[model samples]
Target: MEPWEMREWYADYLDACNRHDFDAIRSFVAPGVRRAHLPGGADAWVSDMADLFHAFPDWRWRRIQLVVEDDRLAAHLRGSGTHLGVFRGVAPTRRHANVAQFAMYRVTNGRIAEFSGSADEVELLAQLTGTDR
Candidate 1:
């Protein structure tokens, strides 16, 4: 796929994520996909996202930046959500937090073949718990 096509595919994928559309997510992932190491990885990625959305049903992704090269795309995003349910083993405290994250993706045949992301885990924990990480 062309770089522009890859960009659009990525945008759509993020849109799906923001909407918590698992069906759309399935449409963009290869069957039997694997993530190298992330503690349950791809399955957990999807499930955790769903869990997050359940906790913060209004969470939204604000694109900070995007770069595309060949079949890979890097995206930076800021997400904000209100605490309304359990998250990462913590009960809801009605706190809201904004998190910045970066994701690197490898696309194959217009579908996400591999994805890895990192975020300010310490800050997220601190914001959620009212303590320093």
Candidate 2:
């Protein structure tokens, strides 16, 4: 796919994520898609996303920047959500949080084949835990 096409595809994928549309999200991923920081296949990634959606029903990803090179794409995003359900053993705080995240994706045959990302976990934890930090 061309660079612009990849960007469009990624934007659509992010929209699916915000909508919590699992079927739409799956359509963009390969059956064997690998997650670098997680152990398991595409199903596992979907499950993880489901859990996240459950915890933060209004979760959204806003693109801050995007860069495409060949079949790889890098995205910097601002993720925000309300704590409406249990997450990581923590009860709902009913507070909202905005965190920065950087994700790397590799596309193969027009489908996402690999994904890895890092978020501001410490800040997220602090917000969830109601800590001053």
Leading candidate by TM-score:
2
* lDDT tens per residue, model 2, 1-133: 9999998999899999999999998888888898886865778878888988898999999999999999999999999999999988889999998899999999998778998999777888798897977
What clash count goes with each model? 0, 0
Model 2 lDDT, residue 102, Cα: 96
Q: Quote the RMSD, in angstroms, for model 2.
A: 1.2
TM-score of each: 0.89, 0.94
How much is the lDDT of residue 62 in candidate 2?
Answer: 97
Candidate 2 error regions (>4 Å): none
Which whole-number lDDT from 0 to 100 does residue 19 have in model 2? 92
Model 1 residue 105 CA deviation (Å) reads 0.3
Q: Write the residue-wise lDDT of candidate 1 on 49-109 in tens digits.
A: 7888888888888899999998888999998888889888889979998999988888887
lDDT for 34 (candidate 2): 87
Model 2 alpha-carbon miss at residue 1, Å:
0.5
The lDDT per prediction is: 0.81, 0.89
